[model samples]
Target: MSLTDDAHLPPGLALAWGAPAKSNRLGRKPTQSVEQIVDAALELADADGFAALSMPKLAQKIGLTANAIYRYVRSRDELLVLIGDAAWGAPPDRVADAPDWRAAAAIWTQAMVDRCDVHPWLCDLPIRGAPMTPNLLGWAEAILKVLTGAGLSPSEGLACALLLDGYARRIASARRDVRDSATTSVQPAAVTRFLEPRLQELGYSILASMMAGNEYSDEIHDADVTFGLDRILDGIDVLITQKRSSV
Candidate 1:
């Protein structure tokens, strides 16, 4: 069975995929507003990595006691979910009216990457559950609509969404690393020295070669996102063509 079908997927993911609802109980009364807490947490995350985001630190930064913050969010993981959705909430207004589904998807992918560019810490958060919040669900719905027009099967559409998001997050991580190295004036050779061994192990020696000389220029501008999106769309286009020919 696919990993998507694994029993270990998070509860929210199961629910989003039409699994049984686990609970209907009401949540606790809020003392701190969700917006206030999320705004403070995002500030901390943008300044520091996610590891720096403990409940105590967030509380201190927000001028509240650590325990007081709990009235808003149950845990740091929950805060992460909020921040991820919030950062992605500002997806470009243009995605809905691109010239074609492929063009729309490419825009969608870049918008996601742009969010990560501002919130580098978001690149590290794990997507343990399916989307439940409005911002996240809206992005998902947008991608689903684009994919539906591309003629992907339901499962293909879902997988394409996951793959595009995953690529965007990975690019965000790479952007962070590249920026840090540049700020420190670390030599490309030094980066290659450390990463080359790992690259070799992964059989990505070609990437190691590119990193050695800074050959991977920033001229690419979201091209990583566009390239992966186009490849997926090309596959879907084949399916669309087949359906048309059969008619």
Candidate 2:
């Protein structure tokens, strides 16, 4: 949806796009810009976690009153949207240089993984719906461009985009969880030893063999990500083929 007026846009989208706030009571001009607020919010979220980044904490980080941020955003969810957009940044330029739609999609998805690596806190934000912020919409455009170029309709491309987005978030989230557990949980070797016996007794011969051979561990590998994305791309390719033939 095209939104030119700040009043029509959500608080977060407005803040992210630098839309002027709706006319309000005259008061002392705030010393901070929206960029400053988002920058400080990003730093705070990185130092702590997204959950710890309350408005009060953000205000303190920027040396403003607890209620000062209210002038910019109406609620915490709005601020979170702003933060998520900033974290996502811009889609990688390599996507445009990719040789094919499949390559473009792969680059786009890998960029997501790289961003998650930089800001592991990104996967923590609640999905409020489709992309609305400027940078995020840019990414949406990038992915959709490739998908449509491959012959899929806009609706089909969007569905495929959601598929890619879901995979990226799930892989990033699981990778983060595994890395966290590996730090505090029993050693992988110890866990493998404990589960191997149970696997054998449960009549799971294949799993038991893999465990005994140490084919599995707590390590989060990009191979699984590549595997999952390949399957998704294969499915999308099938759809593109079907749609192209019909056209």
Candidate 3:
């Protein structure tokens, strides 16, 4: 369905598409635009995390009353959808001379990771449903095109796209978790020190050995993300190979 099709669009989705909510105006014209509200919301989320996006708080940041904020958004949930869509913006430009579908897919997935790095709050936003916003659907379309170009059926291509998208999100979420933990509580170094003495008694022999050898570091998380992403791509390669063989 088209992004602008409002025949049966959900209220939150309509808002994402800039559909003004039905408003009963009383006095003067509203001061803030939906774009302004979403921008302020993004700023607030970036500064204070997604949990800090209450209407009152957002209004305070935007220098508007809480009720005035509702003129642009129906509720926090709708506002979140708007913020997410705006933050995601547009997908990466398609590489005109990408050598293979795998290269194209890698570029697409890495772009998503880079986006999440910029807006780590994206990991905190709850997944209400599948991609409905223009940019999100665009990203999905790009990946699906790559997969289908590699010989997968549309259904298979969609499945593979979903797999890759999920993998990207998982890596982003994991990165967010590490970031949040570092800011809020005990640092990883301290945690490692605390756990080093107890690992043998706790029966985590491999973990204990790594800790004992001073092998744990932030780079390990980066390595894990690379390993997981490459492994998933490798599996997709097997599927693509089988599809070509059957043809």
Candidate 4:
């Protein structure tokens, strides 16, 4: 029935959580459902971009008047909240069964990156704050559960989850930029090749050495993600180890 007693709750958010809404249709039974609306919005976003999603465009796509669409969703912002939750959907299953927290956390974080792969527009959504919606919070809870099980306190676990969340966001942002960049954009490897010979001529032997074997040159991809995960998880491991020692 009612999702919450608080009347201030936005209709779209309540509907996203499967909560009942304040019916506004006057003497007319609904012709469509919120799920259908959200699904169409998602398809529009996936095909175009998040910028193309608006009440008017969505209405045209779904055969509803611009104003009529408001009968299903309150506003553009509310629609975005629903889209985000839908985009994230749910966390990877069985992450909790991993042999260790570090392994589980790795699976969880990479899964976030993979989600962005499906919906590249996800990275464009401005993160107003921490995860609060059903699906997003489910992701956070999954990560926090693993970290807390590894002997981290609740606060410590939350902080670690934030770290992992930011890491995933950054990775997705980098991937999106590279994907959306101009065709003429120079990749790091190309730049490195261009700079290699000049680097030694400019008294930059160390720079030339790293670029000699392409060690310091490559496009951002899973390798970078693995490198970052290793360092971040290593730091967390140190903390967990210390907590274990003290206990």
Candidate 5:
């Protein structure tokens, strides 16, 4: 649903959009604001990952009883929504002097990647829906302006935005997974050695080749992310060209 659909918004969504503050009667007086609760939740998530952000744990972190935490947020889910909004903060500044939309779009996408790098836990948060939060919508608006200004239709521009966003999330998730796996006992070299013989026996020549070339190494580096992003942008350029040619 649209963020403006205030009449029937979920409690978490309403709070996120700054709906009238709800009265809290459970405690003597709340020492923490909703922003403070969200801030503490973000800090907890950053330090210990998203899995560690239960109500009891977070309440302990902020020196509140588990029930006292409910004074600010109705439930852990609402707190998660608030934490995500806080983590996103604000959109990156627009590139005013950029000569083309592609450059501007690249800047936008890179800003998202950098944000993910800072809060890698963001990659762990499941995307329940579209950009309802303010910062997220701001990011979307920035990119849409670039794409539509480049002569794409609104629908086309939105599609490209989704494409770029998916690419960034996938790359970030892959990198996070690789980093997490590195902490375990299994090593990439050992896995490659074990799989090579089986892959060759199964006649998966391409898989064997990649294994031999170290392409299956469990590391997602900056160059790999850049290559994928450039390819996506290149595809969008082709679409823009086709649209222009037909006009």
Candidate 6:
């Protein structure tokens, strides 16, 4: 009874949609619920960093043996995905009718960033494939819908989704690096101490020149998403105009 046999579905769309409710592993209910396990994992990550998350530690936290944890999650990576999806939760609500396409798109991007700020641990999820969870796919669908309505072709809509996701991940990676460094090192100001005097000796003039040669900022702040999304949408607007003209 695989969904694949249905002719109406896009290829692999059923699998990509997410796991079925009928296959929820009902009989295998552990002594501890999935919510308990994920909450324990997230708390551990928030306190001690992602590296501190181990099977034994998580099992101990949730009152289960290390081997027992595998019944619920096949691997550490899968557990990580669950944690990330949990951390992300539901997407923020947006107006049914945004004044314009770019406005609608910016709202979508900002909602993602807000989620990232709330659950910084989400930034650690590996960037390899479509999220195999309903909530995450819903978020992706919303983003793509915004682009498609903005006069982008299907391929262009997909490209926009990838590009926006790349931007979000880049920002998240910078934050993760800073947090990891602080956790592992004795020197609290390692990055700043290293860069401060170098800039002081050279001054803003040479710093500006060096920056021109290498464009990109390592800072993970609200502006990272806002400025980047605005610039990206501006480019998309130009493309939309061209697309309309060509038609």
Q: Using Cα atoms with residue i matched to residue i, what is each candidate's TM-score against the true structure? A: 0.71, 0.92, 0.84, 0.90, 0.85, 0.71
lDDT of 1 at 243: 64
lDDT of 1 by residue, 46-77 (tens): 88878788999999987777777766665676
Question: Comparing candidate 1 with candidate 5, which one achieves the higher TM-score?
Answer: 5
Please say which candidate is ahead in lDDT: 1 or 6.
Answer: 1
RMSD, every candidate, angstroms? 8.0, 2.5, 3.5, 2.4, 3.3, 6.1
Which regions in candidate 4 have their CA more than 4 angstroms from the true location?
Answer: 1-7, 182-193
Error of 5 at 121 (Å): 2.2
Top model by TM-score, which number?
2
Candidate 3 stretches with Cα past 4 Å from truth are 1-8, 20-24, 94-97, 183-205, 217-220
User: Per-residue alpha-carbon lDDT of model 2 for 1-247, expressed as tens digits?
Assistant: 3345644765577667676654434386867877788889899898887999999988988888887777666788888898889899999999999999999999999899889978899999988778888989999999999999989889999999999988898888888887766656467688878888898899998988888887766666778789889999999999998988887
Q: Cα miss at 13, model 1 (Å)?
A: 11
RMSD of candidate 6 to the truth, in angstroms, is: 6.1
Candidate 2 global TM-score: 0.92
Predicted candidate 5 versus true structure: per-residue lDDT over 179-236, tens digit per residue: 7667667777888889999999999999999998988666777788788888999999
lDDT of 6 by residue, 1-247 (tens): 4634534543323332444322334456558655677789889877876677898899888887777876655567666766777777766568235777788777766767667666676676665576556677777777777777878887888787777777766666666676556644454256545655677677855655444444434545666657877898888889889988998
Compute the lDDT of residue 185 as modeled in candidate 5. 75
lDDT for model 4 comes to 0.86
**By descending lDDT, how would the candidates be arranged?**
4, 2, 5, 3, 1, 6
Task: State in Å the error of residue 64, model 4.
Answer: 0.3
- Local error of candidate 3 at residue 214 (angstroms): 3.5
* Alpha-carbon local distance difference test for all models: 0.71, 0.85, 0.80, 0.86, 0.82, 0.67
Most accurate candidate by lDDT? 4
Which is the winner by TM-score between candidate 1 and candidate 4?
4
